[model samples]
Target: MKNTLKNKDISQTPFRRDVLKIFNSHKNAIPLSVIEQELSSYNRVTLYRTIKSFIEKNIIHEIVISGEESKYALSKENKDTPYQQHIHFKCRSCNILFCSELDKAITISLEKHKIERLDIQAFGICNKCNIS
Candidate 1:
């Protein structure tokens, strides 16, 4: 089966489709390890580089939780394509990166200039992983 999701070389990697599946299924945040486990066959370096490419392409964004490690999740733009502009959240304890809707959570309007690349991140305890 051909992967309609255009992230990488779809012709070669069927497992890559699982990565996109996460975006479709979960509205919450996810980390690289979670992604790796979901995809199954993907290796460490390959997954890492694949994630790096996703970040570069704006298919997914990275997050660095304050006092914790980093995580990655999909962007929230409805185009279903790479828009390269959106906000994210990071859980301090879990280090999970969540793709949040900027317009809803935090109203942001740039003066005159259009927002080409958006990387808004909030680091704290997430609702599910809150330590308190």
Candidate 2:
């Protein structure tokens, strides 16, 4: 965690550390509501700014959802690099999203266009959901 903060040049303030902790504890992208619930003291504006800063620093990546609340997940690479190509699975039954790496390399070409990042999400039932 310290390495991540240092790499991003973010100060190790208590609030910032706590916010980063929340992200570290979860393997999936989470909504702001979850963070608010987990932390002791909640301030809407402060949380917003923290999240904004994290995003700008490439410490986290926003997950695009359809007709649902915004969610954020930790980036694959720490420093502003094109996020490692990976896949995110969103369980349709439980509404939980999990990230996983692809076993084989993927190549994409966009004629005359450059790609900064690639986000791929698949929706289905998670293991827990499938069991119950």
Candidate 3:
């Protein structure tokens, strides 16, 4: 049940429940645009506000890709929550998301910056998605 219902601190936002619901269905990250499209009830302002809160609270982290759209996934390891931080990989062809091993995670910050949190996303074709 822990994985099912992630403890959320959303006192500041009204549409917070809707925003948290976004991560419940998918195993991978979804773009803000896509999430907006999926949850049509909340208006743009609410979505943006909720996203901002989530980012600030470390509930979600941004996924960076070269040509792909910006994506966001839950940061279970965030201080606000008990979830553990894990890296992700998105396939170009199949678009499937995989949770990479934390020990195997390649990103390592040598120096501490002003950044509050960091997550690494490596993009490429997975073994099954690879073309022969």
Candidate 4:
């Protein structure tokens, strides 16, 4: 986490390190409320600022699904394209949001139009939930 902060040119503070640890511990995207609950002693403003910094520095990316609060996931390093272009999955059963990569990349083309970013989201019962 310290190395990630350093690479992103962000100051490595104790609070920032703790925040990153929370992100690292989870596999799925997480909401601010979960972070607040985990670090109950910290002020809300401080946590918000830390999250903002992480987002600005591309250490994490926010996922906004309709009718739900935004969630954040750590950005993968050394990718050719922006991580947001990858598909996002939301489990209907578990209500967990996560990133999923497809076996083959999807491509779209349009004449006289430039496509910048693409967001694809799938909703279904994830494997774990399907098994239960």
List residue ranges in candidate 1 displaced over 4 A.
1-4, 7-12, 78-97, 104-120, 123-132
What is the clash count of model 2? 0
Clash count list over all predictions: 0, 0, 3, 0
Clashing pairs in 3: 76-83, 77-83, 77-84
Highest lDDT scorer: 2
Q: How far out, in Å, is residue 94 in model 1?
A: 8.4
Tell me the RMSD of model 2 versus the true structure.
Answer: 2.6
Task: Give me the overall lDDT of model 2.
Answer: 0.84
Please list all clashing residue pairs in model 4, or write none if there are none.
Answer: none
Q: For residues 106-130, write the lDDT of model 4, one tens digit per residue.
A: 7788898997767799999999999
Top candidate, metric TM-score:
4
TM-score of each: 0.57, 0.83, 0.69, 0.87
RMSD of 3: 4.4
* Tens digit of per-residue lDDT, candidate 1, span 1-132: 322455443333555566767656666666666676766577788777766766666666667766645666665443464444456666668755566554544446789887555467677888877646
Question: Which has the better lDDT: candidate 2, or candidate 4?
Answer: 2
Write the number of the candidate with greater TM-score, choosing between 1 and 4. Answer: 4
Q: After the best TM-score superposition of candidate 3, give how far the Cα of residue 54 lies from its true spot, in angstroms.
A: 0.4
- After TM-score superposition, the amount by which residue 16's alpha carbon in candidate 4 deviates from its true location, in angstroms, is 0.2
Model 1 worst lDDT run, 10 consecutive residues? 1-10
